[model samples]
Target: MNLTDATLILLLAERIHGTDEGVREAAKSVVKKIPRGKRDLIYNVINSPSPLELVRHVAQNLDT
Candidate 1:
């Protein structure tokens, strides 16, 4: 897995797992860096059952 991608996913996880209000604002800022078409995909992974899934999902998508 790309460390950069994994790090992004991990950081996103940290943000979301914090206070809801901060995450709401932060998510808007963070998601903006991603392409519009892929924003939901990132959000989905962030809310996924496990953090590792985000890493796997990011690695898979990044490889494509």
Candidate 2:
């Protein structure tokens, strides 16, 4: 399945806090690679009480 960059980042965030050490590290690596602009979007998406509709849609479908 193809996921947008934002969706992939959100999924990585979920994995970062997961029990698997290797997966967490890999997720962190990818997260760190996210550019500054995208990082802002990520922060907003994670912290906002009401993020944009598209972000919300992607977040809802993310596999936790």
| Residues 1-64 of candidate 2: C-alpha lDDT, one tens digit per residue | 1125645655555445443343333334544566655555455454454334435465686576
lDDT of 1 by residue, 1-64 (tens): 3334434645565555644434344444566576656567546545655545454455567657
CA displacement after TM-score superposition, residue 4 of candidate 2 (Å): 3.8
Q: What TM-score goes with each of the models? A: 0.37, 0.32
Clashes per candidate, residues 3 or more apart or on different chains: 0, 0
Instruction: Give the per-residue Cα lDDT of candidate 1 at 34.
Output: 62
Q: What is the C-alpha lDDT of each candidate?
A: 0.52, 0.48
What stretches of model 2 exceed 4 Å from their correct place?
1-3, 9-31, 50-54, 57-64
